[model samples]
Structures are given as structure tokens and as C-alpha cells.
Target: MSFAGFEDDIGGWGPPVELPTGSGDIVRDAMRKEQVIKEILAAQDDLRALLSRVNAVQGDVDKLASGNATLQTYIDNLTMQMAKRR
Candidate 1:
């Protein structure tokens, strides 16, 4: 006997009805949505920049590791030659 705004017996309103215009709420909502979109775009750009930095750092790490390996191999070969001569 008291299901005035509800759709079914779940006792919950289905959805909020749109109010009459000229109340400035529509403008406010639009501005809020725009701000949120701008913030999201800015966040996305920041993430992209961070990822690029990480990739660059990874490349540097790889290069250092490769250089270290190469240097170690050369040193080992030189040491073996000196031992054979002596």
C-alpha cells in the first residue's frame, strides 16, 4: 500500500527523475563533468610521462649491465694471456 515511487516490491526507487530546468543544476553538472574530464586527461598525461621515464631508466640499466659483462670478459681474457706468458 506504500509503493509510491518504487518500481517493484524491492522497496527502492527505480531512478531519480530529472528536475525542471532553469534551476542552474544542469549548468553545474555540466561544469563538474568537464572539470572531471580535464583532470582525467591530465592524469593520463602524467602517467604516460612516468612510463616513458621508467622505460628510459630500464634502457640505461640494461646498457650498464651489458657493459659490465663485456668488460668482465675482456679482463678475464687478458688475465689468462698474462698467466700463459709468465
Candidate 2:
């Protein structure tokens, strides 16, 4: 059977590989190779998605850090004013 439809599920890295019939050894080898290629492509896609999520989390951390600094400054200013009134 042709593996043309299988490539779409694995990120569509390339065209599908056609395996020959009638030879057990040759067909087994081809199927093994195809499975390895699909695994590699799937791993690559997973890594790309993980990197994108990491970048988004980093941006959120930066925004939180900036807001914390602003709040600290405001608190310090208020504390100074209160001390002066005491």
C-alpha cells in the first residue's frame, strides 16, 4: 500500500515513500525506514511547539517583573511620606 496519506499526520515533511511488494525483506526495511522518519518529524514538531510556549512564558515573566518593580517604588514613596508625618 502507498503511504501517501500518512505524511499529513507527521507534519508533512516530504512526499510519502512507496514500498515495493513481493519481497519480505525489502518491504520490512522500507517500512522500518518510514517509521523512523515519521518519528523524527514528530519529535521536531513537538520541539517547535515547546519552544513557542517557553517564549510566551518568558514574556509573561518579564511583564510581572516590571509590574513588581513599579509597585515596590510606589510603596517606598508612600512609606517615606508616612514617616515624615510621624
Candidate 3:
């Protein structure tokens, strides 16, 4: 008998795991381990995606900062010109 494609056998397609017969404790432990592994993999994938998004936003912030510096320089120059006109 197999649950979630994990056959309770000696030689199988997936990794050979010996499960206890009629021992609900062992079976429950295996199921919990499988669930934890799946969750960990999902979290890893999510973290990678979040990191990529953060890097992209950081690049945009750098561009915005560069533009802000250029605008500030232009404003300073305009202020000097207005003072000379007075």
C-alpha cells in the first residue's frame, strides 16, 4: 500500500524507506517529515523570488537617487542665476 506515491516496500521507484507495519507512530512520523520537507522547499523558492524582487527595487532606487542628485544640481544652478539677476 502506498500513500502519496510512497510505496511501503523494500525496492521501489523512489528512495527506499522502510516503514513500520501497523505502527501508527512510525507512519505518522514519516508523513510529518514529508510534509516538512515540502514546506521547506516551498519556503526556499519563495525566498529566492523575494530576493530577486528586492534586487530589482534596489536598482530602481539607485536610479531615482541619481535623478534626484541631478535635479538638485539644476535647482542650485537656477537659484544662483536668479540671485545674479536681482
Candidate 4:
């Protein structure tokens, strides 16, 4: 009825068993995984901010293109008037 020679011990089980040596390594690995996840999330936020800025720049560029088109039309009209005067 005895297992490994400690059956009579108060707990009816043997003395505390030593955990496998790799137990601490398991905890460290979990911590590393969590840190990696946090870094990935921060990078995602940065990418989102960068995307927002890019979108804003695209809007400004579109406005500038429209303004340039208007200026070109105005310049062409003025050239025609000058030629007529000459």
C-alpha cells in the first residue's frame, strides 16, 4: 500500500514533490509572449496614426491639384486677352 516509501506520512501522500525543472522556463516564456503581444499592439496603433496622416496629406494634395487647375485656366484667359490687345 506504500508508494515510494512514505505511506505513513500525515498527508497520506509523500513529501512535497519537486516540480519539473522546466516549470520556471514555462513562466518566463509566457511573460515573453505577453511582452511581444504588447509590442505588436503598440505598433498597430502607430500604423493607424500614420495612415491617418497619410489620408490627411492626400486631401491636401487633392485641393492643391484643383487650385492649380483653376490657376492654369485663369492664365490662359489672360494670355488670350493680351493677344487681342496686341
Best by lDDT: 3
TM-score computed on alpha carbons, candidate 4: 0.69
**Which candidate number has the best TM-score?**
4
| lDDT tens per residue, model 2, 1-86 | 34865643553566775656546788787988899999999999999999999999999999999999999999999999999999
Write model 1 residue lDDT over 17-79, tens digit each, in one string. 566764469888788889999999999999999999999999999999999999999999999
Q: How many clashing pairs in candidate 4?
A: 0
Steric overlap count per candidate: 0, 0, 0, 0
Worst 10 residues of 4 by lDDT: 5-14
Quote model 1's TM-score: 0.65
TM per candidate comes to 0.65, 0.67, 0.64, 0.69
Local error of candidate 1 at residue 71 (angstroms): 0.4
Looking at model 1, which ten-residue stretch has the lowest summed lDDT?
A: 6-15
Off by over 4 Å in 4: 1-24
Give the lDDT of residue 32 in candidate 4: 85
Q: How much lDDT does each candidate structure score?
A: 0.88, 0.88, 0.90, 0.88
RMSD of each: 7.0, 11.5, 11.5, 15.7
Query: Ten-residue segment with the worst summed lDDT in candidate 3?
Result: 5-14
Give the better candidate number (1 or 3) by lDDT: 3
- When 3 and 4 are scored with lDDT, the better candidate is 3
lDDT per residue as tens, model 4, 1-86 = 66685556555366786656535688887888899999999999999999999999999999999999999999999999999999
Candidate 3 matches the true fold with a TM-score of 0.64
